[model samples]
Target: MDTRTRFAVSAALTLGLLAGCGDDAAPAGSAAGDPAPQATGEPWYDEVTPASASGTTGGAGSPCPVPVSFPLADGWTAKAIEPPKGELAELLGEALTKRGGTTARCEVDGRPAGGGFLRVWAADTPTVAPRAALEGFAAGSGETVSGQQFRDLRAGSFDVTEMTWLATNPLAEEEAARNWALAVQSAGQTLVFAVNEGLITERTDVLPAYRLAVRGLAAPG
Candidate 1:
């Protein structure tokens, strides 16, 4: 698979991992004192050092377990779809911690002529650091990633790495051009904030909202 496919597949897998969590999830690989999932050889970031990471409350009475949240901008609307299951679940569940993750999708500009959806995936894993997971997914078969560098940035009190990539259609025969996925990862979870350039003509117009979404995500206080 190409890097593009790796990116999308990894995101989907993260979501699937989230859907697999039972109320009684153990810390990834402690069952038999053995590593449950195969290792990808990716290096982990430094441990989460801060005593408190910034986060927002789930409104007054909302019940979603995800610690982070994203905003729905003017042209955006939430998507309602059943979570992944069965063999699909088995496939995506492997690389992630059994503790699972969370996903949210929204249509942009009501999905106008060229508009698409902005999707975010956040997963909590005992074994994988947010940066390592992001790097692992960004690694595609044998292709080289060009023109981008990972940088340290802060989202509220949470320290994160910001990585940008040219989004492409994974299923296309040739890597067809798409928008962009401005992904940020904190110590506890990975968040992907995507934008469809085809749908929204001016990238600048949507950046502020995207930045706000990133800042809004916070681990439990």
Candidate 2:
């Protein structure tokens, strides 16, 4: 597989690992007195997590450093994750770190984690145009439906570009889903955040969450 294809596949698995599928009708989180309902059957990769079961929006534990810290929308649980490693690490180059919305439902590799995924890295382009950076990244993210469509928007004082696409998960064969990404130039680096709604089952609309994350984007003190 080529670079984009590899990136896309890796990302898909990462998502799957975060968003585990299930048949239980129970919501994502359990009530204080209620325990999380047991799944009726094996968790599928394409299970649709209900919006009511959505995650809490906020940082976990301590505050993260600049380029990593950003305010998340409500119904999201955001926190840092280990960086990409080995080949994935080499491919990203110039240092790459990750943060995820653990409660956001974007399932990959059978893992049901969260909806929003964030990556901030050293800029690899001479121009700082967010669209260019977003598109460039998408181009290498394997074969996308009609490639990546982009739009302009504002995230605080920063101008932001959002891109969306339907990406095929080659490893999973029959599975595909809608994916969206936001790119912003901040603190002399490029910040990219993305979310996915699997196509195999009903998809979730996470535009609001994505936009909220954009507004929260900021530089560290």
Candidate 3:
């Protein structure tokens, strides 16, 4: 099988294992305000291994640093890329296409998430507004979504917003829900994007590393 297929299979298996563990809700004290105590040593997750060219390129400008962090899971990987453009749905569609994935725009809680390209476009390009998007996305998923915003993190030549998403996985009920975070910044006409997932079921514990990775991004002029 191809590398992408392998990655997808691994992700599916991991999700399955997490789903099988009943009461996947993160242990108590994992809320946005109650972040886990900082560890003095190395991050919990391992560094990302490099991958071969995937026909993807960085967005037009450099990525600004955002203050976020998360533990990198074993055997998992992460990569930085340019944020999607065009209408929100179009952009999402394009990105997913690169991964052989498909996406649709639908509503979340009477608000739009699936096809709300305009909302995203008007807000700001390459900005990290996961809360806004998740509010709608979660409502659509029928899962309660909650998170906090880390504001004013400056990296490179852009300002960034770092937000975390906490929700129960509707499809993988036992997978401790899914905790994901993203760092977004705008540069020139391009948006810088980075994402980290499967680190911890709790948003607070995983955000620091997510923030760190965002801050570390350097986009070329």
| Candidates by TM-score, descending order | 2, 1, 3
Candidate 2: regions farther than 4 A off: 1-64, 83-122, 125-127, 145-147, 170-172, 199-205
Residue 175 in model 1: lDDT: 43
Name the lDDT value of residue 48 in candidate 1. Answer: 13
Number of clashes found in candidate 2: 26
lDDT of 1 by residue, 173-199 (tens): 544332334345444446554543332
lDDT (CA) per prediction: 0.40, 0.43, 0.30
lDDT tens string, model 3, 1-221? 33344345334322322111122232222333332322222222213222222121132221212222222222223332223345774454343323211122110010011110000111133243534443333333344544432323444344443333444444443433334333333443222232323322233333333433344445532
TM-score for each model: 0.46, 0.51, 0.36
**lDDT tens digits, residue span 61-132, model 2:** 432233434554445443333444567554553122222211111211212334433433334542457666
TM-score of 3: 0.36
* Regions of model 3 farther than 4 Å from truth: 1-144, 147-150, 188-196, 199-212
Best by lDDT: 2
- Candidate 1 local distance difference test against the native: 0.40
Deviation of model 1 at 181, angstroms: 4.7
Candidate 1: stretches off by over 4 Å: 1-65, 84-115, 123-127, 140-145, 167-190, 194-208, 219-221
Q: By TM-score, is 1 or 2 better?
A: 2
